[model samples]
Target: MKKILAALLIVVSQNVLAQTTQKPVLHGKNWVAITGKPLAATAGAMTFQKGGNAVDAACAMLAATCTMWDVLSWGGETQALIYHPGQKKVFGINALGVAPSGATVDYFKDNDMEYPPAFGPLAATTPGTFGGIITMLAEYGTLSLKDVLEPAMQMAQGYPIEAQTANQIESNKDKVKEWPYSKAVFLPHMGEEREAPHAGEIFVQEDLYNTLKKLVDTEQKALSEGKSRKEALQLAYDRFYTGDIAEEIVRSVKEQGGLFEMEDLANWQVKIEDPLHVNYKGIDVFKLREWTQGPALLQSLNILENFDLKKMGYNSANYINTIYQTMSLAFADRDFYYGDPDFGQASPMEGLLSKQYAKERAKLIQERNVEDIGPGDPYPFQGGTNPFKDLLEKRKDALSYFEPENPISGLEDPFLEEFLLGTTTVQAADAEGWVVSITPSGGWVPAVIAGETGIGLSQRMQSFVLNEKLNPFNVLEPGKRPRVTLTPSMALKDGRPFLSFAVQGGDTQDQNLLQFFLNVVEFDMTVQEAAEAANINSYQMQSSFGAHESKPGAISLSTQTPPWVRNELKKRGYKMDFQERTSGPINAIWFDWKHGTFWGGSSNHGEDYGIAW
Candidate 1:
């Protein structure tokens, strides 16, 4: 009997060690609902149908998405903004959380080796992003918190498993190894030992369910009692921050040596600031600053303005080369200067976005084949070319490039490891010619402070560092939100909202944004066509880190572009990389200022679908 039991256990262990699934795919257009995910979209769309404005719909969807798709949810923070044509005001909300008041850099000085793996406790910043939604609802939204939270509160109560949800849970099981609470909430069906389960599995979260029950009860009861808006919001915030849920998180973070403080929670405030605004060729562009690398998004538009993108053809090799030249310069600046403006000043804003810099940078995009041009305004390393064609090649089982066992680095062909952290973006427009663009995420991992609140703090710490060659007074510190790779954006031409867009796949975000923006703004493609157009991701060309030296300009291009475009780009001194899809799908909405109603479109290059009513 003992021997038989051992054999059974062995079989079970092997199954747990090996789990796989088709990666989740959620794509859409028309921007009916925009939040952290599709689940949020569904919830928000329902609210919209129930007579909510974009802000109401967004707030509701964002809250619900935090629970339904909490992988990118609260317990961390959310920094978001909106432009309302009806009000003609750009509202900004900083929903980011704050670091523990007591924690300091000395905390990490004692344990550099164990220093919370960048995304770990040492990376704990703040978790106040949802405050943005709260502030928006209070200021611009029509519905009460009770009305908006219903969809989210409902989803938290014993919700059935979604295929994508289950798949994400399974795919991220290894990530759960550090937190038992997460294991219980996610791997409930995986046996007592907490292991990965097969597909079609039904996992339940009793603790999360209870947490949802409290949130729902407060929300539902508020509506039943016809509570005032302030009362309802206070109730919700109290439940999350001052009640049991808050205690639960505080205990967790304390145990983890995190820097979160109750005062940070108590004094938490979301302020409405103006977005970083700029104009390009009669188009107005805006990106919320502070927590996002939004300036980078704007810089792309500025640089493209210096070139004649339309003359190069939409996906021509020369066109893609110009893109590489522009973005590499922009990103080089991003790596050097971007940070929390509250704590530091960014010098690159002037030079990076300047037409003079763009003109200087344009010279590097040689018309004919040119030899390796040294990286401009970029970190110095080595060899590479922007090979746009590389992204177009087909990918299947073997495309992952790296498996657990391989753990590759310093190879003949270096990988852009930065691609590991995924992000989410939404671009949609309202019927009133108001465009909506939002980028919400904490990159992969906890981004990583845990056990503090309902959600883990973001691991956005790795992106910031001290500058050696430039200004000083910027010492890495606690309580500061690190500048992110996210740069959700929009553009206006002749005082009309021309484009609503965002690129959300980490390092690829900026690259994809540059190409798609040029494709539409300069190359005259439709919104959908612009997003779908073939392009290259500069990261693949330079391989993020290792090949930053040896990386030839290997551009990762989508396969749809003309073959001649690839050959021509190569002839123009550019290197090409082939990936089935190099850039991530971009979501966009454009408003015809002359026309009263809004026109929306979805990117066809990926799993995108759009809607407008």
Candidate 2:
């Protein structure tokens, strides 16, 4: 019986480790590009074919997705992790917009609002995507801004609208009508039953096209005046922030009762920052700073390093409980501790990512689910007293009030909808060794176009809290950035880039990424397999989107999850739900150092696609 049991265990291990992906792994000798739309991915490939490096290709892709409105636009935010081959270093691009001048905690609370409205002119931040794109092109790319913006420019002239976006506009036509500029753009047939454009209909945005042209024209005009490449790029950047573009943006925003001003646009600049990192075994994983929820992934990894995940088996009951409980602990810290580090109070990030802190937190995990997981104290680990001790106690007492709504079996629940708010990801790599992973989001369908700019204003200001008790560092204030959900990930083995990855789900970004990383590293799955694998999502963390609520004991499992595993998790006190697909459009690129090539992965969850050569 013992021999038979050992043989059965080996067979189960083999089945768990081996996976056949729905899509083939994209192989590239020169470059690879993957994103949320086929046309956007093609745009990256076009840039690479034009003799541009990975950064240039990535910028092209970002611009194309914005033009295509793949859950983002020019007025949205951009966050990225780029692996620079020249410096052998990973650089972070913090282009997330800051709260406008009138955006204050008291201002929102005075309106009797729990949080900022989820969408509208009033929810906008200063536009950040264009600044991020131009900065990347000028600093790291070798191509001209015109060269990279060409693909997006042509698409803005007229591109076939996809069904997903078209239908989203149709479904939200009521809300879209609230913004005059948006109504003018989205509803081409205002009187028709189907006001939104049809799938394959030629959708033209002459305003957007002209807006892009102005930037390109500015660069050319600067070059004609004998300005250097970097100087020319900076001039074009100025055109958007402090020039005619800024004037128009401010005019329209004020006309629509939004809180944008000339100074907000002028003062908002792209920040080049060093990314946070944690060494997991031999691989050094990098993420954007605590300003985003990125540090939570590092904290989760530190705790997870204490166990051998492979022995636990993939998606096993024990593995699910471990990941679920571990994520709860990490995200609990994220909710209370993570915020814009450059603002009001400093985050104890040093202690949050400490191995000792992780071990201490890990020891709190029990045989069953921890229903009342709260933020752990990291101040002592960093040799300081807990300044938020009183707040922590208050938070623990209030956790019960924030408990998830009665368990809903299906995916249509309001909590799940808010938890899975979407974004779009961009991944690109080149033979010269430059790599980029970007998660650009905000301004999805039903977005309010900011007047004739044809740019959809970002609703990211909704991410901020109006009270210090919710999150002191993330309180809404003039010129302060909100704690965002967007995070781009990169990993380095030895001294070389190993992986570049990002996904499109809010709050669940790090949860999916942690599982994806383990899938590739510990399970030895191909990048494609890892991208397609089932990932359990925990709603135990406060959402970064509408309402800012959390479901402490709720967990979503993939339909492919075995019945026995489901039953086991239930026994551990989980309120379970199931979904046909749980992996939220993860796009990744793995550097095959031995083969001197790149392997790209685009999840089958959505319209995400990839191209390689």
Candidate 3:
């Protein structure tokens, strides 16, 4: 009986190993691109083959993702980091929407709600995806909006829903079925059953196709009058933000008891600004400022730079522990200091990225595991009072009301919950030196599909805090953008563009990117090898959503990690959970400046694709 059991186990193990698919490192000299979905990559590749630059291809891919990836819709938030070699500068576009004028904490209090509902018109923010892509094209792209949007429009008309999209729709069918418009789109064939489409089944959004076609027509009408491409692009933008589409969206939200209004749409625009970056080892890693969690990557990198990472060795217990500890401290600072920089009185950039602050914060990581740490006094380095101290203390008292009583399983934890709120990413680079990395998110499952527009309003308002006194990201006046977790990353090696990449893991985006970056620069691994390696994720700080829950000393390791490493981490008094693999389906493109070639890799965890030509 024992011998028979051993033979069965060996067959099972072999079967499991055979089922695993290995992704290849895609390479090209002229251009390379990667996206969260295969069709999105095809759209990008088609654009590139049509003589479009990186910006053009990236915008095309973004639109295609909105159509094919149900998690991202036309009415979503987008943040991009673009590198323009001609200007020798990197620019960030903050395309995240803000709370409406009626979105005060008092408003929710009157409704008898402590937090915004995850899926409803009340949680919707002004859609920014349209404005963001149009703005990028107008400023940097050489292709017409019509040209880039053609593939996406075709896709919206009808496309085969992949397994991931099908699974997501099925998982949220109970909530989505309640919204007639959403049900009409995601469960069109269910006929009261609310079943998701089977994989490879044709899924069409006629309203979405019409909406995109209208934008194209709007641009063409302007061009017929001999308007420049930029003028025509602005007309397309106005069509979405200030024209009929905006009116329809506002009307739908208002009818559903939500607070969106025409004024919010009319005033919506993507903010173009300089990017924030830190020099780690020899490379300069770039990200957006505080409105998003991009700076957390910089802060964490700053902290980790204090250690000789190479000496510690990649994936070593000491290395993993140090990175997690550093990440925890950085995330703590993020919870306190990261808010809309335009609305805040002080900025923590100087102190948070300073080497001195990193050294001081690094001391918090001792031999044994240290759990949750509060935000440090970064203001002293900036010559300002720390605004978060009082708020932190107040929050500590409020923790009794928020922290979970039972220890949660890793699968059902807040990290996975927030991550399920899904995002999609695209990376494109042309031989001419333009590179763009964009993360488009929101309008997730159970989204409120606006009336007849094929647009789903973003539930980004859930990111805002109802506690005005204790939350720096508190709901106050209208038009103040909520602090977001959508972070896109880029890097420069020796004053030249070197890499463009972004992932869609909510708070884990930066954490995963940090590991991938270290894998390449610190350990001399290829982009594919680095991305596929086992990694660690920490939940030792407040989550970006829900009750902002924090599980002190909580960390997750890839099950693929060696048993000795896991045991060593356990011996160090750290709380650990093991996952089958890393969280991200990260997409990245590495620009090999020395050889003038582009190397790309996309995670196969989902239906991600990498194409080069």
> What TM-score against the true fold does each predicted structure earn?
0.78, 0.96, 0.94
Q: What is the lDDT of residue 402 in candidate 3?
A: 31
Tens digits of lDDT, candidate 2, 1-613: 9999999999988876664778888999999999999999999999999999999999999999999989899999999998888899999999999999898878888889888999898799999999999999988999999999999999999999999999989999999998899999889989999999999999899899989999999999999999999999998899999999889888998888898989999999899999999999999999999989988999999999998899999999999999999999999899889888778679999999999999999999887998888889999999999888888877754432355455654777776787888889999999998999999997888788988989999999999887667777788889989999999999999899898999998999999999999999989989999999999999888888888887778899999999999888888988888888887789999999998999999989879999999
Q: Pick the candidate with the highest lDDT.
A: 2
Using lDDT, rank the candidates from best to worst.
2, 3, 1
Clashes of 1: 52
- Tell me the spans in candidate 2 whose CA falls farther than 4 Å from its real position: 1-19, 397-406
* Every candidate's lDDT: 0.56, 0.91, 0.82
Tens digits of per-residue lDDT for model 1 on 498-523?
A: 76777556667767776777777676
Query: Over the stretch 1-613, how does candidate 3's per-residue lDDT look in tens digits?
Result: 9999999999999977764336878889999878888898999999998889999999999999888754778888999999997998999998888788688878877888766666788787889998999999999999888899989998888888888888889888888877878888888668645488888899889999999999999999999999999999999999888899888888878877788889999987789999899998888999998888888888888888788999999889999889988888888777767778777574678988888888899989876677646778887876777766767677665441232433347777655576434588989999888999998898877788998899988878777776743456544457877778898999998889877878877778888888988888889877777767777877666666665566776677888788998789888877777888774777888877778899897886767898998
Better of 2 and 3 by TM-score: 2
- Candidate 1 C-alpha error for residue 562, in Å: 4.7
Q: Between which residue pairs do clashes occur in model 3? A: none
For model 3, the run of ten residues with the poorest summed lDDT: 399-408
| lDDT accuracy of residue 423 in candidate 3 | 84
